[model samples]
Target chain A: MTTDDPSFSPPSFVPFERLCLIGLGLIGSSLGHATRRAGAAREIIGVDRHQPNGQKALEIGFIDTLAPDLETAVTGADLVILATPVGAFDAIGKAIGPHLSPGAIVSDVGSVKGVALDVLTPHLPAHIHLLPAHPVAGTENSGPEAGFASLFDGRWSILTPPEGSDPDALSRLTAFWEQLGATVEIMTAAHHDLVLAITSHIPHLIAYNIVGTAADLETVTKSEVIKFSAGGFRDFTRIAASDPDMWRDIFLSNKDAVLEMLGRFSEDLSVLQRAIRDGDGATLHDLFSRTRAIRREIIEAGQDAAAADFGRRPPSRADDSKF
Target chain B: MTTDDPSFSPPSFVPFERLCLIGLGLIGSSLGHATRRAGAAREIIGVDRHQPNGQKALEIGFIDTLAPDLETAVTGADLVILATPVGAFDAIGKAIGPHLSPGAIVSDVGSVKGVALDVLTPHLPAHIHLLPAHPVAGTENSGPEAGFASLFDGRWSILTPPEGSDPDALSRLTAFWEQLGATVEIMTAAHHDLVLAITSHIPHLIAYNIVGTAADLETVTKSEVIKFSAGGFRDFTRIAASDPDMWRDIFLSNKDAVLEMLGRFSEDLSVLQRAIRDGDGATLHDLFSRTRAIRREIIEAGQDAAAADFGRRPPSRADDSKF
Candidate 1:
């Protein structure tokens, strides 16, 4: 997946004969669309607790069929992806384990890999190959209609397979994600959780907390917050507007790493607070200047959009401009 | 500027004969380009202590002429806009006070209105009108060349004029910003600081702090942080990459309001931290859901671009796609 691999080509591998997706929200539906686009799955069956979402997924061509029950969905599936909230993985694993065919590969798109391993590994059948994966890409949108085939393009898909898993099953899962346009990385479940806590979980917690603080301010009315949000606050709102249920499950499931990161953030914030209190312009300027290099590195690594103001349309593009 | 106004027209007010900008950074250069585009200034004179910045401003036609000293710049100017960092306002005001022409209007484009008023008011002559203005618009990019004429289009420009200020001067300043395509709102300096403290200052502080924390993590290397930033941290980097000098002054100048907002933010964060530690999913879910409505209002009010993913071009646009 690195740029240095000039001889690289998309791997040729057998596609899944029957792929069962347990949740048809943003990630699941997106996987459906991407797999369909890549011809990686012959039959995509969606099983969502919400009937409307399953129906919408079928109508939008995100799935070939919608199963009314978990048993029917996993009956003969070659691959089963648990895309529900991380908290539901234990129950879902228990329900689908008996129904899953022998040699079935079980995977997930959960944010908290360590918790997913803990909860799902105990409930799944030993004959099944459990592979926990996290696709490190998404929009702030959710539901079937929000899914897109290109959502995983150039993104990282991390696989945290259980210890001593079948090498054949791991290779197949890696190739599957590769076909979906994602570069694959393999790591331990605990490492994945810690990495994401700093990159995603803690960042989301801060955004949610800041928005709550602004909304509660008595001196600065809510109307003013919205009106002047372009200053900096609006960016936080976009991240904070993410799916609440999924995020809540993630924070709780990955509590220790998130707590550790939060402690570090609070300590750093105290230093900044002291700098402000003491009118230490040098300290503030030095810290602010140092962070710019990290932004450049992110852009250079192709991890973010490089355009100014997050690639927003200029005012001259009146048709697209909200104003 | 309300959407309901059917008979509205762009105001045609008396333009400045000589507009002297005391700094030629992002805001100053953008103002120069905008005023020139709108025919609001007959001659734009730029004064920058950095010689190269003044040269670039002249070369780029951001200013019609470059003044080597503050005295020469303010000698015959009808308008003097202090577009430097807020920390420099006091010294700039004192330096140019005696040379300012009679009946001249002295305004600024500082982020903190209260500090602008307090610092600039004491140095200006009795006959000159002092107007503290904040164009609530900017990108993270700075310098003379990193500006565009349309930067202020459809943005808000807040004015915090002192009591007993000349009515005509206020109207002229308002019309000037309106000509540059900003909607004008007048408020007390104190209120403006409080509103911006919540909307801008505190958000930047949090962004800067979090990025610093991530960079300092021993377990997570800086390369990993940069590689995986797309998860959520990338958005904060954009705001954190803002001009260090300008932000340092903003925090120091609006220390009281910013500290108040920061305190509230810390308290809210503690609540969220406890919820995560206790696995209080309901509390986290409820708070996350409420913030989405604020994002909707910001989009509906045209304060932000409405396109998904912050209006970044779709990946199919091969020229802009990093992958």
Candidate 2:
């Protein structure tokens, strides 16, 4: 978990002879880098519809071969991962199904698990083992150059294998994520979607919504908001800056769960709103105190750094001297 | 501002013969550190109703003297800053008003500006200057041990001077903040409250609200939420961990503006919810894309670090090797 240490490296183990990663953005490229570092795959064959992303991954040296198309990428691969936005899964699944080798394990790194199963299962060949997964990790940045091998270190990769899945295939996929430095959790796709709805999907929606609200404020100038953002507003912006298309797909694909959670969030917010309006300090204090404990749990759980302000670089004597 | 770099110190100037700060938490203690570093006061007097907090501030060497009571702390100080939560301002202002020296300039570092003026103006004598200011900076941590001199470096310090205030007092307070490594902006008390309601107050509210909602979910275990927080929930928890009492006072003191902004936020969120429920990808994508631009503007304005994940430490090869 000491990801910043230069002298550390994970043990190398190959779980797949050929791994085809379709999509060369942040998650895809990061998987390539981590797989190479962990020796999780003998060869990482990368494919992106965007040629420059593939070229950048090649330059980054995580991918052994850059394929121009999905069919070419999956032709001889034993493990094929669709790493694109969840919205793109249906077409990619259909296009690459006929080309996948028998006994190959097909998986995904999308944010929503249920949709992956709903869209991918129908198109995949029965000969190929279909397993879906979501690595609950990412930064706000995109593109191949944004990737790093340690992105998954100490993170969770939740797998949603259908009922009666091949145990060997499930074990191998779990081992693959483990080699890449992620702890694996197995759950039903429905459960995974519901859990992520509260944890991931809704948080992203709220971040995006708050940022949008800040932007449309007629009373507050956009420049003023930007300049004074070191206030709590800036924290929301980090996640709001995440890839638009990907999140759009997440919100649309996981519509029911997201709406359910959003309703609960708004309901809770209204209670706080009433409390603030009524100057109900006790209610506000109780909720704020309860939330503080959760943050401690998160840091203790190693889901976040224990350092204050996410260990952001604090102004030092040296920094002040310049002003 | 390169605040993490050591071996740097700023030129020092003293604006007050004796300065008293009336709280020993994150902002107050940081003020002591930054003030001492800038040589802003010939003698620093610290006051905290909490005996341990006062002793810790003295032990940290930021204060030349620790006073157990506000009256004793402000006895002969030329400048006094009320650094306690907004709720305490009324009592402290009342206690210290008769004890303050003539021509002394009194200020505060409270988040709600209008409340500071409302609570302090009545207690303060005609000869004393009541200038309220807020330094828009801090980490989530609290207490004297969390003090850092560079906390305000490159941040804004907004001064809300009541009408026909002493020009010399205002100028001196502005210079004191500048010397402590902050840029000074003068605005009305009401404007400061409204701007910050969006920039700071409501963001904290939404963060606290969401974390509470997550903790209350029956379908999703708290452990699952914590383990998978990297997806986005963890970002909110950072702000949610901020001092509970301080935030409780902020919401109560700035009720109108916070409520107004919250109403707008809810209206906008309702639109997003509808869009998601109706499968309007374009609506979600457009807002997400627009918000990303604001984040870029914030970075370009030098209000936030441009580094991905707020420059959070990413997993590296060595980190993976451990797993």
Candidate 3:
């Protein structure tokens, strides 16, 4: 409580002379909104290869200034955020290398941090700080318009800093995100990539794969599958609806970790299959009982707002605004 | 088209002078709502061993009457609906056998219809009609109050009748479900059980297994799992939250078909796992692409309403009229 009082008393955030956000897609736009709302920067600017997205970010008040090109955006900007798909990071980094302000902090919101750091660092100037980040929160929706101020509220935003990093940049970035109502965790790039492989990347891949397979079945069979999706399949559809370019780059970049976790999941799944095949009701019952206990923990952790029982309604959409 | 008429005629719903529901759980309660909405029966009485459930159903207006004993509920009813746990069919069958009204059209909403027929038919009066059924729609919820008028709207209700079943009873039951906006499919009991085992039962069992593993991890690891469950884990929770007794009965009753489907699923999953471990991007891409196509067919079938994409709107508290 004593530490928190000073943290809130002054009501000020990390101050930056200039901030740049490259590629104003959903993540980029959200960064612009949070940075602007927190007063973390004197000026916030966004640049996108696509002319309309840059113009739209300006029109939507997500950024104070719009840069028509990459070099123009990073010039003299003290803090730069790259929010493009991972496949574009190397090129964007290379394009802005000569223009980055000396001692400027450069960060990204790519799903895979190891590949991102490896690709972006070689092309960047030595004087700049390159910190990789991934905010593990987003709806399946995409684009600049989908970004909202509260998108990161109560979520986790992980920062993967290279060894011997500048403490000033690290703490500043942490405070900036904390202002946006997100908890900040610091880890190494390699570990961040691995943790996310199980937590986010593999889950997304499995969902996409299942939805894709269901969509490909024989016409009659496919129809029945979708019709009865309420039976369980529809849950996969929302995740599958995620931005294709972002996911494609994620799978392409995080191949190793995702593959490893997928292997474990499959092995575990097979053991379950064997038990079911053997008419092992004891196994199924035991597992089902254990999983319900997890539901209780999730409820207790406030991750699941609803009570453990589905019989009780979750906080409903009395007002769509809550969503 | 000829079934439509210019005259103002109400829909033809099968009517029962007397109706009895043997269980008052989710499926049974939903059936009660459907019948009441269509005026399908003059007096609908419930027979659950838990007398509180019978009283609750009556209090909620989900049933027209309450019967403390099973014999009382079935003795004079023209239509008796067995909605007990699938594993309990034989015991229920024996208890109700001598009390079943002559020429009554008896049916069930058990997930495994073949087992139900085998267990119950020997005990039923030969003169009574036995038409087993499985409604392919449900929330991960249980009990009488979990039902609503729209529960079965646009869902499939499969009727699995044995050989030499009475045609008149078939037409009447079909008409009854159709009034609730469901399309009916008639299949042999064996085929129906196999279909459900693959499409529904196996998937549910897998969900239970995975969630259980996640739950049993270290407390820190498990909490992390829930917080980031926007990944695949949250989807599994909905399935795992299903009623314990009902799922237990399903696993025990449909042992054969569930095992067979589990075998095929395990083989398919292993192949995918190998592709992932081998970093076979092309294989992953192919399977994922195939699944997405299946989702397309499901959409085209008009079986899945688009609103389901957001997930039943989390139910409403403003509407507690059922209580």
Instruction: Please report the candidate that would top DockQ against the real structure.
Output: 1
Runs of candidate 3 with Cα error greater than 4 angstroms are: A1-11, A15-17, A33-44, A49-68, A187-191, A212-220, A305-323, B1-11, B58-61, B218-220, B252-264, B286-290, B293-323
DockQ of 1: 0.57
How would you encode candidate 2's per-residue C-alpha lDDT over A25-94 as one tens digit per residue? 9999899999988888888899999988888889889899999888899999999999899999999998
Per-model TM values vs. the true structure: 0.95, 0.93, 0.83
* Tens-digit lDDT string for candidate 3 (B1-323): 01122552334555888889999988788888888887878888887888778878988888878887888889899989998888778888898899988999888888788898899889998899999977777877778878776676666788877888877787787777777656667778887776676567766776776666555444226656765665456767777877777787787788787766665655566666676566565766666555545544444454343332233232232221211
Per-residue CA lDDT of model 2 for B111-144, tens digit only, reads 9999999999999999999999999998889898
Model 1, stretches more than 4 Å misplaced?
A: A1-11, A313-323, B1-11, B313-323
Q: Write the per-residue lDDT of candidate 3 for residues A94-119, one digit (tens) a residue.
A: 89999898999899888889997899
Scanning candidate 2 chain B in windows of ten residues, the lowest lDDT window is: B1-10
lDDT of 1 by residue, B1-323 (tens): 33223653445598999999999999999999999999998999999999999999989997988998999999899999999999899889899999999999999999999988888888988999999899988998899988889889877899888988887788788889888988777788999999999999999999998898989889988887876777999889989999999999999999999998899999999999999889899999999999877887877766666566735543332322343
- i-RMSD of all predictions: 3.5, 3.7, 7.8
Better of 1 and 2 by DockQ: 1
- Give native contacts recovered, as a fraction, per prediction: 0.71, 0.74, 0.30
Ranking, TM-score, top scorer first:
1, 2, 3
**What's each prediction's clash count?**
0, 6, 14
Ranking by DockQ: 1, 2, 3
Evaluate model 1: give its lDDT: 0.87
lDDT for A205 (candidate 1): 92
